[model samples]
Target chain A: MKKIINKPEDYLKEMLEGIYIAHSDQVTCVNNDLQCYVTKTKKEGKVGIATGGGSGHLPLFLGYVGDGMLDGCSVGDVFQSPSADQMLAITKEIDSGAGVLYIYGNYNGDIFNFDMASEMADFEEGIRVETVLGADDVASAGPSEPGEKSTRRGVAGIFFVYKCAGAAADQMLDLDNVKRIAQKAADNVRTMGVALTPCIVPRVGKAGFSIGEDEMEIGMGIHGESGIRRGKIEPADQIVDEMLTQIIEDLPYNKNDEVAVLVNGLGATPLDEQYIVVRRINQKLETAGITAVKYYVGEYATALEMAGFSISLLKLDDELKELIKHPVNTPFFKQ
Target chain B: MKKIINKPEDYLKEMLEGIYIAHSDQVTCVNNDLQCYVTKTKKEGKVGIATGGGSGHLPLFLGYVGDGMLDGCSVGDVFQSPSADQMLAITKEIDSGAGVLYIYGNYNGDIFNFDMASEMADFEEGIRVETVLGADDVASAGPSEPGEKSTRRGVAGIFFVYKCAGAAADQMLDLDNVKRIAQKAADNVRTMGVALTPCIVPRVGKAGFSIGEDEMEIGMGIHGESGIRRGKIEPADQIVDEMLTQIIEDLPYNKNDEVAVLVNGLGATPLDEQYIVVRRINQKLETAGITAVKYYVGEYATALEMAGFSISLLKLDDELKELIKHPVNTPFFKQ
Candidate 1:
């Protein structure tokens, strides 16, 4: 593998160690456990926002823990779910007596562990815990009906859910209110992705999957799961159009709808390429009469060094628009 | 080649189109020239800081143009210097009678063009333009004497110079003071990098260079220029240690010297690997009794999709410490 890591077993631990060393002023581990990281900003009576998932996707679960965002995160190995104990530990650390909300992706292992953690937190510490699973990857599962509860694999669109929910929590919203906002964000956002290359988990020491020299995969999962279509590489505009079409149709964003567009690079995709994709998205949206009010183009979520990009759109209302604009300062994300 | 682009010849234009579309609120093209981009925040009395370089490195030259940072940038094609006319246009757009400063990398083509632009601006518009070229890659040239003017190639360490200079300019420092701070930053910072793989320029449609699958080139330039050493890839710690050792000795940093550390990804290098490298740098600095007061770890300067990372250290004094902390809100950079 071309990865700049040491022993395969040391990947996650060393990364956590580095994160703590670099951001100690803003974040800390719960009871010195690296797997349970929490923000140092403790505002009493504010509803706690907690998230967790597999590693590899930086700035997603862990990188979002800081001012105006998540309060804590349970970290796991690359593409592997964190243990329930780790999640529970994070819950105990972030809870400030206003209850804690669990926000994470809709992966089977993560769903299982986060649910268990919620149960354990309630049983062991009498902490009220709620959950909101991000299921915004429209390619994973199409919405059968409008406003349906999707089983879609969560991807880059989870960031919007975190932003809305975190802002509500920071404003000292009640648990039910915060959960409502989180659910709203979960319902409104949709994402679709294309991959040009595969990334290897350090332990695996080889690419998880392979693509031909001139090929790309549409709707590929972050962990190299089977995509909906695998074919020869298309132009950036064409690729973006295909992805955005799926996302727009999935949400069926109406004419005159306002959106916050996120053009996310998987890992190795350059910012230049992401912007090119953004240009196409903007054109498509304009043609569809959907207005893009905000643009976030960069690597927000990634799969190791995989080369590709994802397009996520969050259809916004007045409440969601105001909440999304709320300021945030985190180790990886800031506004 | 595996790239998500349309026409290779249209790469730079398309990328710029996307950038303008995404960040039009903060930046604008001067006189309808896409190659000349300037910030929209006009402060009449503040010193205008302008920078430019090749197009591939995002969040570097053009990305720095915004509030509290660069006021303008002259954009070039991939790995090529922008035209002198472009520089003059940017200088004219940003200058508000307080004068403008040209801050860019110490590349021959850039130096030649920016110098010409400065002369043209002074000759035509009576706008004073001072220049500070970032020459901080210690691996490119060794310091024969202490505090010597390096002829080294500019690399990721240029971001520190931009931060320091931009902050100084934003604080309404006179042209001389801003230029002095920029020079101070340019002199004190040092960087070294390693590349695991080569990147292909779009128009070229082939890898710029090649290395063995298991080998890495230490101190490789951002543009794939030859480095000081080539060998089998080592652990992240070892690579970081080697790079840090050279940076420390080049400046001959002493015990208790405070510094701001920047672990920058070139392109394909993942945040996980960069953090692993950061962990080593932290440990090494601690062992050497150097205090690290700030950390900026991410892709600040990149070479398209090259697989590598660079380590930069700005030996910070109180003045630089305060200036670096000054607020900045650019499209790609925010603090």
Candidate 2:
């Protein structure tokens, strides 16, 4: 594997050490534990927003912890879930009278660990915690029926959930209110992706899967989860049209509805290619009478050095519109 | 070729179209031409900062055009310089009576065109214009002796020049003062890079250079330029040590000197790998007693999808420290 890394075992640890050294003024680890990180911008009586998932996806779980965003995050290995103790430590550290809200992707291992951490925090520390799973990948599951939580896998659209929920928490919203907002964002956002190449897990030292280079896997998850279809690669506009069609139809975003577009690069895709996809999306959305009110085209989420791209659309109301525009400061993200 | 693009000839046009659609609120083209883009956040009396180069590197030439940064930019095809006329158009559009300052990479084609633009702007439009070429790549040439400017190709270190010069302009410094700060940034910063893979230009439709599966080219230029050495890829820390050694010796940064670090990814390099490099740089600088005052890591400049990374250090004084910390807003960069 042609990767810029040391021993596979030290990958996550060294990455965290580098991050801590670089951004000590804004972020700090919990009790010197590299697995648990919390923002230094904590405010008393403000609801804490915490997120966690596997490593490799920088700016996703840990990068969100900062001013006007997540308060804490527990980190995992390459694609493995963090321990419950790590999550509990973060929860306890971030909670200050106002309860904590857990915002993470809808993955089985992550859910189990976060749920266990939630229970331990309540039973052992008397700290209240709420949960909101980001399930916005339209390919993994169909759109939720009315009054039903989605069963989809979360991908890049989780950024919108962290953004809106974090803004709500920063506004001093109560735990229930913040959870409600997080859930609303989760419900509104939809994502679809196409992978041109598979990424290698450091420990594995080889790509989990492979395509014929000139081929692509449509709807692949960040962790190399099985996608819906694999076929020869197509042009940028055609690929974007396919992804956008799924995203719009999944939410059934109606005429005159507005959205925040995130054309995220999955690791190795160039930013220029992402903007090319955005060009097609703008044309398609304009034709559909859906106005994309804001555009965020870059790598917000990724899968190691996988060569691919994902398009996420967050349908917006006045509340979400304002929340997404709220100021935020983080190591990876700034607005 | 595995790329998300339409016809090869249309690549630049479509990319510009997408950028205009996404960032219309912050940027606009002069005379409705995609070749000349200017920031919308223009002020009447503030000195204008203009930069230009090829189109492949996002956030390098064009992405810096926004509030508190570049006032305008001229864009060319991939890895090619924009024409003199396009540069002149950008100069005319952004010059708000104070003056326009040109800050771009040090390259033969770019220098020729920008100098022509400078002459045209002065003789035809009576607009005062000054130029500062970024010659910060320590790998390209040896360090400059006292009273001499180094002859080196510019790489990602241009970002530091933009950050300092743009802030100086935003503070309402006149043309000469802004040019001085730009030149100082160019003089103080040094960069070195290593590439594991070569990128395929869309028009070329193939890699410009190739290496063995387990090898890397040290000190390669962004556009497949020959490097000082090629060998089996080493561990991340070892590679970083070699790079940092050259950068330290070039600047000869002394004990207790402060610097701003930029561990930039060249397109296909993962962010995680960049941080791993940063980890080593942090350790080395600590040992040397140099304080890395700030860190800006990610893809600030890139070579299409070349898998590599560059380290840029801007030796900082109190003035540069304050200027680097100055708040700015752009599509790709923010502080």
Candidate 3:
């Protein structure tokens, strides 16, 4: 694959520099390495918000770091989690005097690294560090399987936790309260994605997976993991219904429960199709008697040009609703 | 190609319904048949902001209509312009006592229909209507052929105008002032795009154009128009330089000129690649003695699943800088 870069290894560093330059007023380089871009605001008594995971997903980890959102975000190589040291550095920089809260997706590498970093911060720096892992992809593991919780991966639904955690932090909520809000958002949320085509990793110069022109993989992970099922490409409305039904069944949300629906285009799905899917999904929600208090349709969390989308539903209450509705100024998602 | 719609004709209408549901508190459906979505806020005595175009590009027209941006947006069939009647109705609904300002990208169909609607609004309703067409794609047409100015096609650079115009309107600038600012933004702007692969229009169910794996088309329009040059897919850095050279030369921004750079992903380019391109572009600007006051990198305006990107630069002065820095609360762009 032809890519524009001085060296493949230096790609991430150069990209981070560009992000900091564009958002200089709002963001700054955390360390000399330039992997982490952090917000300039510092609150002595507020909980510090830290989120990080992979590089290709922009406006997610990087674009989300600003006022009313993340305090710091550490970016790794494409689709790869940052090392424990990198996470530790970012946590240390943003700790302020108050406790630091690590809100990240529930991917294995990220979980392990963040956990290690939190422990390191607690022991070495005497900073209180708490974490909330987002595991909202219902398709990653089935209910029938035991000891499969570890296998359940985090996808785009992680944004729900970010919003909740960010709002809590902005309001100067304690670490425990922030953790609770983040966990509540994560637990109430469920997502399932389908991939019409595979994404090519620039370094690899090949597709992460293979799919025929007429087929699609349902419940595919953002990083191109094998999906739960594969079949011929079906109508968009049917595909949306199937994805929504799986999520609804997994969560089994009550009829009166209010929810925030996020119909996210993975990367390559056109806004045309995303809106079409959202229409059917809204119909499904109405039929089930669920009140969609808040709905977001866009490429909130995306795979690199993976022609597909995911439906993430976060069952909302007074607190979650307020948090999600809180005004955020990010490069990608702004309210 | 499989899609998620029940009926092809109902796609746009259903999609508009979904958008309203997502942002119900902020936007409402003006006309179900026309797929017209209008913002709830009606600023009295302010130049009513309005924009509309095709449907596949999200956040462009629909996501952009909100508190500080557009008052209404008329979504067309995928990659097509709205009818004159649709534009007229939206213009009528959003028109406050002051007047309605039509801010649109320059496309043959859109310009013609919007012109017709403006005439009707003037003759029928006596509502003063002024238009500022976004003609930022410098690569669309070469130096003026005898008796003709360059036919600059509108691409992603339209977002810059939206920001400036919205800010002007939000500040209650008169229609003439708003039009002047928007036009200045449009005139100062220049963009160049290249497509690695053609997009697949949902309505058409086929690729918009053909390209081999190692091929690319430079100066391609948003809707898969034939480019000025077709060549082998070059490195990302080279592609960025090529695009930047054309924009820089066409606009001829000087050393003392402050500018806002928008390195927009045309849907399918990964964030990593976008950052890589931005890094190089920033260096080029610095080397040219140009000061980049603001920069944006994301899928702001897109050609559905077209694996490409465009660079937009607007020479900024005091007024332009203030407008660019103004806070906007649109669903897609928040500052």
The reply for model 3, stretches above 4 Å from the true place, is: A2-6, A142-149, B2-4, B145-149
Name the regions of candidate 2 deviating beyond 4 angstroms: A142-150, B142-150
Candidate 1 regions exceeding 4 Å error are A142-149, B142-150
RMSD of each: 1.6, 1.5, 2.2
Model 3 accuracy (lDDT, Cα): 0.82
Q: A263, model 1: CA deviation in Å? A: 0.6
Q: In angstroms, give how far residue B57 of model 2 lies from its true place.
A: 1.1
Of the two candidates 1 and 3, the one with more favorable lDDT, higher being better, is: 1
Better of 2 and 3 by DockQ: 2
For model 1, the TM-score of its B chain against the native B chain is 0.97
The 10-residue segment with the lowest total lDDT in model 3 chain A: A142-151
TM-score: model 2 vs. ground truth: 0.98
Query: In terms of TM-score, how similar is model 3 to the real structure?
Result: 0.95
lDDT per residue for candidate 3 within A255-302, as digits (tens), equals 788988888888777766787787788788899999887778877888
* Model 2 lDDT, residue A251, Cα: 71
Measured against the native two-chain assembly using Cα atoms, what DockQ does each of the candidate structures obtain, in the order listed? Answer: 0.85, 0.81, 0.61
